[model samples]
Every structure is written in structure tokens, then in C-alpha cells.
Target: MTEVCFVGDADCDLQYELLSRETAREALSTYDLRRPFENAIALSTVSLGAAVSLCNDLNWYVVRFVDDVLVREPSVDDDEWLSRELATAVRDGDVTGPDTGEYLKVYGLEEPEPTPEDPNPKGPPALVEPLYVSRQDGAVPEYDLRDVDDTVVVRLTEGEFTV
Candidate 1:
């Protein structure tokens, strides 16, 4: 199966910006998946066709995030639900919300640097920032699957497909 993950440096480089549910809904609309990604890649054998389709759909947002990521810099909208539930939290002097670390771990990913000494870093703080990921559920890909895939890797039998 196609492992849905932020596997590469390129994907990690994409700032982990958590979109508000409404904002994400809008983003989804751009792709005609106005609804949640109700699709599934087979658990153990993702077909080439499914991978191609998912890869293509994900590529569009990758481009979009690269272009507009900075505009929503985390210093302002760092937390996940704040944009929806706590828009005035910062201005009202309330503690905002979670950071990059708390968010990325949910996806079994982590960004070691939450803040850098550069004083003016180049990209989003690692792990703490929730990067935009295309998903099979509601806003931001939620691994809220009912049946988690088996942790054990399954290898094909040596002669399973041989004549």
C-alpha cells in the first residue's frame, strides 16, 4: 500500500501549517474533493493507478503550500483549532494553543527544532507545526482509521507469483 506519510525532505520542508477546518474545506474545494477524501488505497497492495491518482492530487497542494505557506506564518496562526475557535486568543491575552511538536507526533513524524537560534529562521519550526497533508478524512489527513494497519510487515511468499 502507498504509505501516506511526509516521507521526504521536500514534504518536510513544506511548512507544517495547520489550516482551520473552514480554510481546509476551501482548499479541498479547489480539487473537487469538496467532500472528505472518501477514497482508499488497498491496505497492502496499492495499485499503480491509485498511487498515480493520489500522487497527482497531492502534488497540486504541494505547489500551493510552497507558494502561500509563509503568508500564514506560525507566529500568528501556530495552533490547529485556534483559527476557528480562538481567533482572538492572542489579542485577548489568552494562551494560544499547541505548537509544532504536539501536532507532528500525531502523524508519527517529528521536527527536532521548534525554534532556531538564527533569530530569523528560514522555515516552519519542526514537528510542532502541523503541515498540510491530503487525507482520507476531515480537515488535514487524520489517521483516525478504525483498523490500524498491522505493524508487522508482510513479505510475499518466495514463489507466490512464479510459474
Candidate 2:
């Protein structure tokens, strides 16, 4: 299965925005949605091509409400995710195998703080700003932007590497 995860902009309510719009809602009607992170929505597709197609189908809404589009194809790497552009490239045969691991965007997985009302906070982790890095010797550096319980490493194509 290829999973596509949509991370929303800080000010947007991603779920409501996508589900409320007729076109976006229609495009997403077939899949079961999952929230793997705060302000994010995820769905699974049979293959990388289908995942890219789904993203393309929702591009209008994605551009307006989404901050990031991440795709995970188990055939590539089960532990790391791929940027939408990279995923598209892979599906289109522009990238393959170990070449996919060269550039990366590492995001910190920050857990919500405990509050008086909810001491033991239990919600999806918030993804922090991504730190773009290139892989060296088959490994990328640890995320050091902030304190986080974990990190999500997203592979990127050369075109999508901001830094």
C-alpha cells in the first residue's frame, strides 16, 4: 500500500476544508481517512501511481489548505516517507532505488504539552518545521531544531530540496 499524508497549514482546518468542498469530498469518498498527525489527514492507495493521482485530484484544495504532501511507498523504504514531488517522480520513473535516499526533509515529531485540564495529553504529534539535509554514507543527521519525541524523514527530489 502507498499512503499519502496531507499536512495542513497552521491556520486551516484541513479535514473540514477537504470534506466540506464538493469536488475534494468527491475525490476522497472512496478511501478511509486517517489522522496520523495533528492537523493532517492520510489515506492509502494501492500503488504509487494511484497515490499521486489522488494528490493530483485534490491539488486545488491541497494548494489552498495543505502545508505538505507526504507519500510512503513500502517498496521504497518502510521507515521513511517521500515528498509529493519525489513520489511523483518515482511513479513516473524519474527516480528509483537508492537514488531516492539522497536528499531529505526531516521533521520533528513534537508531542502536545500537558495542561491543567488534560494532564496526560493524548493526541497526534505535531510535525515541526522541516530541516532539509542530504544523506551522507547512507545516513542523515538527527533533527536538532527542537526537542521532540521522534522525527519523520521525508525523501525529496533535487527539485524539491529547498536547502
How do all models score by TM-score? 0.22, 0.97
Candidate 2 lDDT tens digits, 42-142: 99999999999999989999899999999999999998999999999888988795689988999999898999999999989999988899898888997
lDDT of 1 by residue, 1-163 (tens): 2222222233432323313334433433333211111111111114323333443445544345432111111343322222211223332445333321122212222223336566544432222222333323333445443333211111111122121
**88 Cα displacement, candidate 2 (Å):** 0.8
80, model 1: CA deviation in Å? Answer: 31
Clashes of each: 9, 0
Highest lDDT: which candidate? 2
Candidate 1 C-alpha RMSD relative to the actual structure: 19.2
The 10-residue segment with the lowest total lDDT in model 2? 154-163
Tell me the lDDT of candidate 2: 0.93
In model 1, the Cα lDDT at residue 138 comes to 31
Q: C-alpha displacement of 106 in model 1, angstroms?
A: 24
Per-residue lDDT, model 1, residue 84, is: 12
The TM-score leader among the candidates is 2
